[model samples]
Target: MALKRSSSMKTQLVNGIQLQEFEQEEEINTSSSNNTPSEPAEAKAHTEPKYYTVEEAVETIGFGRFHVLLFVIMGSANIVEAMEIMLLAVVSPEIRCEWRLEDWQVALVSTMVFLGFMVFGVLCGYVADKYGRWKVVFGGFIWASYFSLLTSFSPSYGWFIFLRCMVGCGVAATSQGFILKTEFIPAKHRAFLLPLASIFWMLGSMLIIVLGMTVVPSMGWRWMIRFSIIPSIILIGLFLFIPESARFQVSAGNIKGAMSTLDWIARMNGVPLPEGELREPEVTERGNAFTLISPAYRRTSFLLWYTWFVASFIYYGSVLSSSELLEKNLLCVTDADAEHQIKHNHEEALCYCIPFNMADYQTLLISCLGEVALIPLNIALLNVFGRKASMAILLVLCAIFFMLVNICTTMFGFTVLLFLLRSVVSMNFNVVYIYTAEVYPTSVRSIGMGFCTSFSRVGGMIAPFIAQVLMSRSVIWAMSPFAAACVICAIGVVFMPIETRGRALLQHG
Candidate 1:
């Protein structure tokens, strides 16, 4: 009786399982039949490609070997710019003697380069935005190289001024290279790496000084200018290896080209391409001068332009005034009247082709090295304090140093103050670059940078007048304005509406 009952229970259990399976199948069929119209749509949705933005793609790739390569290649732009700008300060003393130029004329040589930089600054940005970054960069390299080479062969001061101005045009165009670089860099790496890129600038500044110590003294200023062309030549070749910025390409509506470039970057970096279709960046008003002044950007633009102007004024003031300061300290001119008299006599003579001695070069080199030494500090402040605070702090410190520099009675004292001044001013400049790149959207980035840089060149255009010309008359005139400008910039920086720390870049205006 028990065996029979066990056999019946086993049968019932198997039958129950079969019934449950049948019911589930029936329910599935009923559901599928009822939802047939939506079935294909759901399947289609599953099969469709995913979309991603440029920032999303960059984040996935992260910083890799490819970025390191880009950093070096794109950072070459800073190096080249530094060499050109520093060459003015290094070579001007010699040029003055060669042409029997007055102090104002000597100042104008430096002024003209920035004049061209100012005039073409906005234009280059527009061209870069409408066209592409690499084209502008590549063309700029060519334009600058040709004109810079011609500068060495300049027969008269007028030709030299014109050629230098043309070089400035190229330099202004190349400023877009920074924008191109900023696009590729992930936000996480921006604070550290962007400030670190100033190492290239420091290297370039030092290189010109080294050449000042060696080439200008030996082969003459022409040869030094001739030799500076070599970096441009090398850079033009390296530029071939790097691709156009994917961000710019996407914003400009060349999605396929952007995808290809991104794919190449992925391959080069030993990573897989991001798993999606590259979404087109949102359409916005094409970047123009008006876009910069739009309500969205107006206050930021105003503040940023002023900040750029101040940074350039203080930085170039420190640099151009270095030679004069060194001269004053070296002469041991304790009295203000005597210092003025010495400068007057010095300007009238214009006979010493190279005013810098071995000691002067050593001092200049020491001061320049301060830029490198303080870079780690700058990076720290950027990451810790954030961009706005860092800029304001540096500007304030710069102002204090600029004022303190006025009271230095000994070479050691002046060199120390100048070193601090260069360090802070350069740090502020680095912060400004990073901040501007972050604040603007991809569509108007280059134009925004160019516009701000144009204002900087305005400061640059005027800096020589004070640094080289007025500094010759009174130290008070040169240093005081830079100090005042720094204070004003510091105050203005506090009022910026946005803080770009760890912020994702905007794709559209």
Candidate 2:
């Protein structure tokens, strides 16, 4: 059975996530007192009391209508987040034309967004833990969406970068969303469903492609940013519909709230609450996120952080430089239409445009199709192979495919390899989220996630610059480092001791 909070009230007060350990006592005791006191106080003192675990109950209730509804509402953030992350690519060409920006400057604008992740990740994680997950998530959505809208109005490169950085800070609530999803999901389906978040992410990227091919050619980059903000704005209004994690509420010591939350879930699933103690008495202790790296969990902590960093570097670096990679393939093939257009009106040809164009948009769209296909593949991998082994296998394969970019001189071969690499890398990254959510206890789950993500942002920050420099020389130079990183990470994942395949979320330290 998994443990949740119902520890002493003081510990709840000191807990960083503000779990409200004693908040539901009056209501719960009123109902709890009605039931006969089953165990004698003396006997209870001598042995471990029977405690109901929320994990088992959630598993029994299973996912239903409410979960699906929440999936759409809460998970919408991933789409919005993806849109912001890739939005720079959609607009960079227009921005470059207007500002007379060089390749380095355009890359800098894209890189600035992730830089915010590095600066705010740890802080945001702590806030989520100390306050509540939903608060951090709501705040992040507001910050990201508002800045994205503001960024559209930027009068200069400085303003654009600053607002873009703010967008990253706002989306730092990412860890909170992942943790919340983990809490609500059943163990058997956890790994499989978590990757669905990436599907929304891919959708966001595809939406941008549609806009770029249609909207950007006519209205402008500013309108593209504004268009992306519409979802975020609408989601903010729909925020009230999503529920707080009941597991979190119980872990915070709000037994009645937890029960009520569970009852709500049970009702949503059209089932009665399962018979079990939902929480157990715990001798609570307060600690910081550093506790994760303490003697007991240090190995798990470091390994997760290292893998997170490597995954972030490979994924972000690939995405940030994908256009240039596609451009390499584009230049290799002869396009009569592009040539004819360039011969007539150079600026009007999306394919002949200097850095990015309609050809790159088509490539991005095709790559997204491959990513979308992998949602089912990822679900199967997590179920059949489990988290760690699946990640290791995919990482090694992704590394091979990414490096093979060097040998694929023809457009078909190059594009095929790029699509495969993107798909596998997407799977690898989603596995990290599932693994991270299961690795840590609820007490510091968000913080642990945030810390690992911070490491990712560190990679996120530097990967683009590295990609930019190597890409200036050749795509081979950029891809070689990413492929090597993938190999190193693949080797590292083989050493991970935990395999979160249908296992209970590790609760106590």
Candidate 3:
């Protein structure tokens, strides 16, 4: 009986072990059914939400091929605008002969134009921020075009000055064009593209030379003023086809419009909509003029304004003085008969001008070529070197070159040094625009840029008078003041913060 009981216990123990094994298997299956395949905790922790790719972001922001084309077209318009600003410089001799005016009177034409730029630049920024960029830009085009046409028909010097000032008021649209370009371009492309836009100004300078040497001399000074109207009309028509900035739309609380524009861009570029919703930029309660003076931006405003003044003082002073400088230099090289004839007859004046042959063209071309030559240097040095460093280097170099040109006696030495100085100075012109735009928050960017440009205009206005004073004595004497201006620019550059290049626009105080 004991053996039979032991055997029964053994059998029961085996059955219990089997039952335990089965229960373990069932529990494992149930857990497997309830739980997902375990992702490593580290992997889960590191996972990030995908944002749009660069191409996708560009499309989402409405920067497509069509937009690029529009940028080029508008850039050409900028070239035209610059041409108009320098127009008086080219024809100053003729205007002086016709009006029987003093050097100050010739200077007044630029002053009036810049004064209009100063007053209306702020107004345009306000309109651009509050209303829309297109309206201000279009209005400027129409206004400037009509007045430019009127400038061609002025019968008296007073009428001519009044019309030129009116043209200045109309040309306030140039600021709007810059505002649009800044708003439309993506952040990555902003710095490089913005500086490249200055190439248009150089192109405009070239156009002025072309017109002065060709059209104005062949036709009359009035025809040169008339030619200015063509660019305005063409640009106004092209602007009608370009859409308003999507960024501006978003800023103004028009998300639907912004999205629709984005959709078009996406379709155009064959890209998908980015995943996130668009966030509107904060709208400040500050008025346009007051915004520039607000405590948060006051220091920035002061610095940039002063820089503008200095830059304009140097740049416009140099540019306006160019015709006089060239004429004087030519006089040094030419005979008495040629000089006398050039002083009297408009056609003969330009045609038989000193540096009369390919030499003048070569000189102008070399100056312009100096601008193009700096592009690579900018690309290489601008990123690796900070804004302040690059600006300081350029400014110091410009000052050195200016001083060298002032003291040098040989024509070859003067031309080479002058070209180098201009090249260096031109780089600053491009850099300043990029710096001003980058430093300000988007909410007040246009205002900041407009103010900077306005101060630049003030410098331009003051330039002719300063040059007239200096040049009335000797070419060397005129350049002495410019050398001083260069030193001031160099000092300003040294004090500026080094945070502008490749930086996102800061929104906080």
Candidate 4:
């Protein structure tokens, strides 16, 4: 009876196990049937759509409205700075006559101004980093404007030189404005628009020439210098509308400030705010000024400094010498009093020694027409060829033209070539501003650019002296060295890497 009962229990256990296995198999089949079609459908749904945050959308819109507005304001400031720079070149003759200055003495004014720039440019850069870019820019405008206004009151050559040095100190602040622009402008537009920002420079150059021809001779050079103050006032007034750079704020670890500024930019741009982590702290430490010389940046530092020195040497040398060159070249055809008259009223002078009269509408028309034609070319080449290539080509072309100027005898030939060379060289000047802004890391970029620019001012300071001495012998011959310098610059440019181009300011290694 016990054996029969045990057998019955085992049979019941086996039946229960078989029933559980059958239920599990049925559920697995049902799950597989449901998943087979839905897998592809679910993936397809994921592929069909995506979303972006407000910040991503805003950044996609490129530069915000505020950024563009600030660029315009800063660009105007640069124009004013450029006008002051061109003023001495355009009116050197009048200033020399008024002050009874020797060639070296006349050159001292430019040199002193540049000396101030060299000393203060570095200082301003450090200040910008420590305090703020806007502060530096505003200070520069105030400083330069005050000095430029005071320049009109100078009683002697020494007094003027002292005042001009102050002006240089003020103008050194222009680099801060430039850095702010680069920091705010979007990457896609940088390569093209960065150079375009220099349109104000060209405008300033043209303004000085136009004003010199129209106003300076009539009102005297003092009034001409005074006229430069107006632009600074306009720039300062416009500054109220511009904001500090978001990137700069982020780099300084003011994340909250950065976000606030970015939100403002977005609202101005009519776009939503983005969602992302703010920029992290710079891996490299800051505070020590000498860190610019670290191993990673040493080569860049040397190359940029040398390049700035050489480029400034050539650029300022040519510009400072313009008035002296024009004076000497005109002297070949007329006497002192007659040349002065010709400068004052070229329309009335017939068969005068100078090839073209500053006052003559035809000459002005021709010069401006040449510039207009070159603008499109500059705009096209700068973007297509990139900064390095365009700069290299322009330098070589300028060198060749400078050499050709020595050989060309026909007035028409000289006029055409000279005008073209001026146009081309002016275009290259824009390249330096863009390149300087692009090459350095954000932390030291302003200082690097400012230092080089200040050194370039040194070149500017020496230019008049060199030109005066060279012109004291032969005007054409003095320019030959400029051609050689250009050749050297072309070679030096070879070491520069292809620029950031349209890319944003890059991080240092």
The candidate that achieves the highest TM-score relative to the unseen native structure:
1
15-131 in candidate 4: lDDT tens per residue? 999999999999999998989899899989877655432223334657767767877888898788778777767656666667666667767777888888889888888777766
Candidates sorted by TM-score, descending order? 1, 2, 3, 4
| Candidate 4 accuracy as lDDT | 0.69
In angstroms, the error of model 3 at 433 is: 0.2
Count clashing residue pairs per candidate: 0, 9, 0, 4
Best by lDDT: 1
Estimate candidate 2's alpha-carbon lDDT, on a 0 to 1 scale: 0.76
* TM-score of each prediction: 0.90, 0.84, 0.81, 0.80
Report the poorest 10 consecutive residues by lDDT, candidate 4.
344-353
Q: What is the lDDT of residue 482 in candidate 3?
A: 70
What does each candidate score in C-alpha RMSD? 4.7, 16.8, 5.9, 7.4
Q: State the C-alpha lDDT per candidate.
A: 0.86, 0.76, 0.69, 0.69
lDDT of 1 at 11: 100
Model 1: how far is 241 from its true place, Å?
Answer: 1.1
Model 3 residue 155 distance off true place after TM-score fit, in angstroms: 0.5
Minimal lDDT window, size 10, model 2: 339-348
Tens digits of per-residue lDDT for model 3, 301-360: 787788777777777765665555555452233233343334322223322223223355
Candidate 2 vs candidate 3, lDDT winner:
2
lDDT of 3 at 451: 74
* Colliding residue pairs in candidate 1: none
